[model samples]
Target: MNSFAKVITTLIGSFTLLIWVGKLDPAPYPLTYPSNFGNRISIPQNNPTTQAGVYLGRNLFYEPLLSANNKISCGSCHEQKRAFTDGKVFSSGVDGTLTSRNSMALVNLLWARRFFWDGRATGLEAQAAFPLSDPHEMGQALTVSAAKLRQSPKYPILFQKAFGDTAITVNRITMAISQFERTLISADSPYDRYLKNTYKPSPIELEGMRLFNTMPQPRKKIRGADCAHCHGGAKTYLELFHNNGLDEISTDKGIAAITGMDSDHGRFKIPTLRNIALTAPYMHDGRFNSLQQVLDHYSEHLKQKHLSPFLKGSSNKIGGTSLQLSAHEKKAVIAFLNMLTDTTFIHNPEFSNPNHP
Candidate 1:
């Protein structure tokens, strides 16, 4: 063959060899969003989504070896059935120590700009690393975790498949788990279908939705529940944190711990209303047991000091901020909140524990 022909042939031969040895670039994982979700998926360029990477993440999420005692995993607190929440007021660690705050559900994490109730971690990967080292949580060092996963016969292979190498690092582990979590989009709720005109809300549910979206304005004669202000928008939910007037005196000091500002005291991430019915014992500390209690707090028991501006005309304790919802209105709002539950995401086989499955 001529010189140019030989060069082309050599390139082809190398490419074929790489493919044969399973070193070729793998295809990306198919991540689909519902029509109502819109264009809101923000994945980091470094940790791009791939089938192998997401699969590795799924395995690591359920791996107990990441814990100090080899008994706790990410799935230990974020169960699949209860919308990724542990269904407890406070999630317990491997040593039976309780977390300070309620375990936030892990749905629709791709849309979240911050993680955790207090908005401590800026991204999902950073959020994943905290529990591993938290004394009350997993209580394992990153170095120890890397060593334990390296010692595992299955993890190295999974790591190689995900990142094209057998080296297991904390960054890689977190990236994989974050990839898996980004796929946990929950948009197929009854309310989502209603928005698409595929499902119609019941009369009470319709009333609740109306109340939720509208803010009460005595000047303009507009009676509203005013919930959509904080939990509103076209996408999954708002990423902002708010002090919902849960108490007159803040106990945990919430986001203030991170910002060290009294203005930020009691401010917590406004969790997505989607699957709100399943994530019971609501609020940062899981102070309310039922949705009714939550509504009652807003309608009749809300404190005035440090209340979010969104609740200016909706909180019961504040003169101008009170929503003043009647018994019927409160029940209707509860019905609408229930419509946000998405059943498909929880039962998805892809999100199930790989070893258990």
Candidate 2:
């Protein structure tokens, strides 16, 4: 080969090296949340959110190729319009099999340590795998999903941009998905506006807010909804599990299935009320179709033999006798819950399907 041939080969090698290096450094994502949202988010050091990673994750979230039949995606069951919940009692999986529980809303997940009603998954990265491979869900093996992503004309470049290489592994897939999920913050509701002093609640709604935060003191004639014990503060939920008296003997073991402790029986993770008005049917089983039924259950139907201590009344009983909120009071409580619906979140184009206009 001549000197000119050697120079041309060197130029080609340099161009290839530049292309590889160009994708090595993804820009940091501009992550922001409500200032009043309490403690700083605990982002995993290994998978810090990046603009490219979030973009890849967002596309992956809506990509039907992730499922077994190439017809379903994470976005199918967790539609943005219903605050990321599918609005079905139980979401239909890839094979049209029904899920065991209602799909959860994926809002402000950065603050949550546990995933699922049973709290089986310890982190967001681990949580993504369950639905993808669950027999009744997406029903696709992780290896097969990775293979499909790798074969895609677009995913290799996306993986290069997001993970610094074109290696389409399950870990990278989940990490990218978790990055997109962390951006789903819902702090622009009417209730949030009321806290910010930008919006005024009506007389009934204000009364509802007061009642919701107030502790029930039946002996003292103080009527309270006692909601804040499980769902309080700026984030609207305590990151803990509780037996909210859904049944006297719950057929589903809930957190107890994972812990194998009798005390944890029927204990389910406390979900956020940020967009409660839209995420129905409610509860782990999707038993209730409306917020009114949920309120009624707490007010007059709590029946778990071992209810959470927070639900006990002045007499310290494990029954609904503790909270017999009046008809008008129940109405007010529902009004307050409705205030939690953040229209801005559901309509936000940034969180919508990137493939759609």
What C-alpha root-mean-square deviation, in Å, does candidate 2 show against the real structure? 4.7
- Per-model lDDT: 0.85, 0.87
lDDT for each residue of candidate 2 in 77-117, tens digit (9 for 90 to 100): 99999999998889999888899888999999989889999
lDDT of 1: 0.85
lDDT string, candidate 1, 1-357, tens digits: 999999999999999876654442366988786655667667888999888889889998998999988999999989999899888899888778899999898888888878888888888889999998898999998889999999888887778778888899989989999989888888788887888889989999999998888878766677778888878864538888898888888988888988899888889999988788998889989999999999888877667788876675553323555567889999999999989888887898999999997
- For model 1 the TM-score comes to 0.91
Clashes of each: 6, 0
Against the true structure, what is each candidate's TM-score?
0.91, 0.91
For model 2, name the residue pairs that clash: none
Candidate 2, which segments miss by more than 4 Å at Cα? 1-22, 314-320
Give, for candidate 2, the lowest lDDT window spanning 10 residues. 313-322
